[model samples]
Every structure is written in C-alpha cells, then in structure tokens.
Target: MKGQLILLDHLTGPDGPVEAAALMRDGRLEDLFIDSDAPRPGAIYRAKADRPVKGQGGMFLTTPDGPAFLRQVKGLSPGAPLLVQVTGHAEPGKAIPVTTKLLFKSRYAIVTPGAPGINVSRQIKDDETRDALLEIAHDTLDGHPIHDHEGGLILRSSCAEAEGDAVAEDIAAMADLAVQVLNDAEGEAEKLTEGDGPHAMAWREWVTPAQIETEAGCFAHHGVHEKIEALFRPEVALGSATVFIEPTRAFTAVDVNTGADTSLAAGLKANLALARDLPRQLRLRGLGGVVILDLAPMPKKDRRSFEGALRAALKTDDTDTVMAGWTPLGNYELQRKRARQPLTDIVTEEMLQ
Candidate 1:
C-alpha cells in the first residue's frame, strides 16, 4: 500500500462543516480543496450592466451578490442584462471579475457558448478512441437545436476511458443546462448556476479510485490538520533545502536556499527539487497569478534542465499554467490561472463568520 493506496476524506471542522475534500496518497496529503463563501469561480449569473470604466475598457455590472467587472464591453449597454460567468476569485474589496464569454464545464465535457465546434481533447490520442468519442459527441449533440449563436461541445480527456453511456449523459446534461441558461434573458440580476462545492468537485475531477472516508474528523485522523498548519508558514523544508513562500500584494515571492549543503551541485539539486514541489505547494495553497521564483544560485547553464523538470511537473497538473521565462535578475516567472480560493482566505472568512 505504499503508493497504491489513496484516500478521499471529507472531514468536519469546528463550525459544523469545513466543506473540504482532502486527497491523501500513502497517508500523505496530496491535494486539498476547501469550499469558500466568496463568489465562486465558474458560477453563471444573469447580471445587469451598471456602468463602464473609462480608459479601462471594461464594464462594472451588478449581480445579486455584488458588483462584477467584465472586460472588452464593446456593445454592452448600461442596465442591459447579459449572461456572464465568474472568471476568478475576487481580490479583497474589489469587484468580482466576470466574463461575457461563458463556459459550462463538467468532468467529461465542456460547452463553449458562442463558439461552435464539436471537438475531442487532443490528449485522447488513440485514433479509434478519438473517432468513437467524436461520434458520440455528434450523436448526442446533433439532435439538439443548437443555434449558431449557441455554443459547441468539446469532449474532455476523461471521456476516453469513461463508459460511453456515462459520457453521453454528461454531455447531454451540460448541453441541456447551457440551452436553458442562454434562453432565459428576461431575469433580473441573479445566479443561474452555483459552481461545484468541494465534495462534488472532488467526485468530478479526482477520478482515481480511492478509499473513501466520509466520517467527520477524518482530516485530523489522517494528519491533514498538521499539513494545513504547515502551509500557513512561509518556510517549507525540502530535505536539506529551505524554500520561502511569501505572498505580497502585487505578486507571490518564492526564494530557495540550500541549507548546510556545501556541495558544488547543491544549487542545481535544490532547484530541481523545488521544480517538482513548487507546483504542489502553489496548488494546495490556492496561490496563482504572477509568481516570482528566486531559485538557488545555480549556474546559468543549468537553467534549461530546471525548466524542463518544472514543465514536466506542470504537465501532469490539472490547472492551467504558463512559464513566462526568466527575469533579468535570474528570477523565474510563472503565470498560473486563478483556479481556487487561497487556503488562508477561506479559513479566515469562515472564522469571522
């Protein structure tokens, strides 16, 4: 059971429900998801455009919850109702960021509204499987009266191994939901769909089979509380090296230090170790956007190897991330998608409530 054992634990917090999904591999916390009360990313809303921001080329809209901002508002009229999806978690005291180009995403399919094309994931490489998945997409979507203005379907990678009936059902459900939301344009500012909470999201995305622990206090039982407490601290010790992660107002700063290792390859070794661990750290902490990495003092020739390792690590990761190359001062830059609420913010919000 060294690496084969995996656990999905849903635990209760002091406030009755923490609404967390913790994934443990071989008794080690692998990934964590804690539900946040903030305006969740990917929620669909029928919002009313309030006003346009001059020079910013964006519009501020009013939702049932609060004000939301959308970019590239060329034809959106003031007070006009439009469908929008939350793009990311809102910064503290800022308008919730939203986009008119809405997407209905699920485990097996994604319905792209206003973009018409029935496609399969590129990751589904087998010719026969791709063809079958394509056929399934067409067969399921062809009967639906999807207009040119309406969106198209893209079968997700998960569909390749999923049961055909289940894939078709998932696609159909998303398509039906999209049509319903798009046609209802007469409503006041309101939410059309609430994004998936922790438990539901875990079931959707964490497709690997695992031992399920739904009983309360499972988090503490699995040492998840200790792991989470460590995330609150800035320094993470990776063997003999120490990496400091500090999030500032403008960007998150990461510094790697080779502690007590006087070997000539210490910098490269520590940096390579960081290359693998950094993604997991950022993911669990829910930190995204511009990340500045001040790697240990490695030779300029070793940068390529470090980058290759980093890229490989990120490739397996589900989140969208792009390497923005290095800065003039030898710092590596990464631009990651704002996919989840920061762990700190989520805990603080719950405590205050």
Candidate 2:
C-alpha cells in the first residue's frame, strides 16, 4: 500500500518519552499509537494479528546501537543517498528485521507493514507518488472509482501486510470523515455571513471621529506624545511615526518610529510602552489582530521581560489578547480581538489639522 507516511518525532516531554504510533490508512488519522496506558480505539487496532512491534512490524524496541547498524546498511549502497534497509536478528534462525529507512532523508523505523515478506521498491522515495498510491488504496477500499488524472496508475500503501481490500476500506472511511468536516465548516461560514451585516450596523452609533481623536490624544499624552502629536501635524519635524486606519477592517496599524532615533534603547522603550498600551487603544479604537509591535532591538533578557509586561498589561483588556511571542529580528507581535470598528476608522482628520 502507498500513502504519505509521517514519522512523528519521538515524544519527549514532562511525563517522559511516550511511545506513540499513528496509522493513516488514507489521508485520515486511522489508529493512533496506543500507549501502554490506554485501550485501542477501534477495529483497526483490534484486528491486529500480533502485538505491536518496536522497530519494523514486531515489538516495542529502541536501539541506540541501531544507528551503527544502519550505517552498515548504508555502506552497502554507496553513493545512493535515498534508500537502505537494515536487518538484525533477535535470535538465531529467526533474523530480527530492524528496518531503518529514510522518509524525506530523515531516518525512521517502519514498525508495521501489516504483513510479512513484503518487498519495497525504490519508487516509495518520491513523496508525491507515495501519496497518490495511498489515495488509490483508500478509494479502492471505499468501493469508489479511482480518479482519472494525468498519470492513471493506482498507488498502494507502503505497508505490505495490509490486504488490498483492508487498505481501500480504511481510505474510504477517511474520505467520509473529511466530507463531514468540510460540510460543518461551510455551515459555520454561512451563519457568520448572515450575522455580519447587523453586527456592523450596531457599531455605527458608538464609533465616531471625535471618540477616535480623544483616544489618540490620550495615547499621545501618556504613551508616546512626540509621535502621536506628529501624526496630527505633518509639518512638524518629528521622528517618524505614521498612524493609519486600515480600510475594510476593524484594525489599525500604528507604526512607531519610521526614522531612526539617536538612542536605540529609548526608541525600543518607546515602542514597548506603545505596545503595552495597545490593548486599551484596541478597546478605544475597536481594532484587533495581535497588533504587530515592531520594536527596536534591546538586550535579550530585557526583551523577554518586556514581552512579559506587554502580556500582563493586555490582560486588563476585556477582549481576548494573544501574545505571539518575538520574532528572530526582535519585533513583538500581539494579537488582540476587536469586535467593532476602531475609533480611528470613523475619523478622517488629516495630520495637518
């Protein structure tokens, strides 16, 4: 059988490394790796002939020494970077097959193939081709007609043990689940569309230009006065700050410091203070979308501490605020949910005024 095989990173966390497996018959998650703690979910795991194996379709095993074994296998096929299989024997006569293969160049053991003595070919290396095969397996199991596209070849799952019919049936069930999810999403969208117009109408009474200017004035007086005042008077030689209301949305992007400030720390601190008070402005402005606060770079420790403060300040906002953490370039991104138009959108006052 051919399908996209996702080898999850070995689970390592607080509870300690948990052994997990995910069986996707088609595109849908079929049977998850059953931990020792929980029972099997459905017929998929129930029908298993033998207990789940660790390496390749056999037992629960982790081999620190297996990498060395894999290296030996790779040596056999010199210059061929894509594929290799390693076999080890647990006991004499019965050779232990510790199959180590690369999925997208990352090595992962194929623990279960659904059957024995299955031969894997080189074609499984191509991810696109593998996915198509799994799709075919799923469609066939569901008794659906194989879709006709450019190359009309039916693909199968990589697991050799699964019977042709079993693979097809699993895929069909996945397709059915997908259809249900899409239908539910579409229904939700329709409800939102029906309710949107009335919601916008309700905001018209409270969101006004005067309210926006008042809020802007408050932000200027307390947070960043020079930058805020500069917005109202274009002729003023101020360090770069551009405030504009985004059209067709309830969000406003107030960019601080377009021009370089002589003191980098001061500029960053100014930006941080502006970011810290954004939630109140969002309430006053009725704007949202994790306000992207692009700040000047500061020390790493200070940046983290500032981020903590920004998050704490946002908590005062009744609306939802999510801190999206910092970027590699040291910009802080904050997401604040706004229910209505911001004060700035209602007001069209020019900087000169």
Please list the C-alpha lDDT of all candidates, in the order they appear. Answer: 0.84, 0.35
lDDT of 2 by residue, 227-248 (tens): 3233333131223433232323
Q: What is candidate 1's lDDT per residue for 77-150, written digit by digit as tens?
A: 89999999998888788899999887888889989888999888898899999999888888888868555456
Best by lDDT: 1
User: What are the runs in model 1 whose C-alpha is more than 4 Å off?
Assistant: 4-15, 147-149, 348-353
- Decoy 1 TM-score against native: 0.93
Could you give me the TM-score of model 2 versus the true structure? Answer: 0.29
Distance from true location, Cα of 182 in model 2, Å: 29
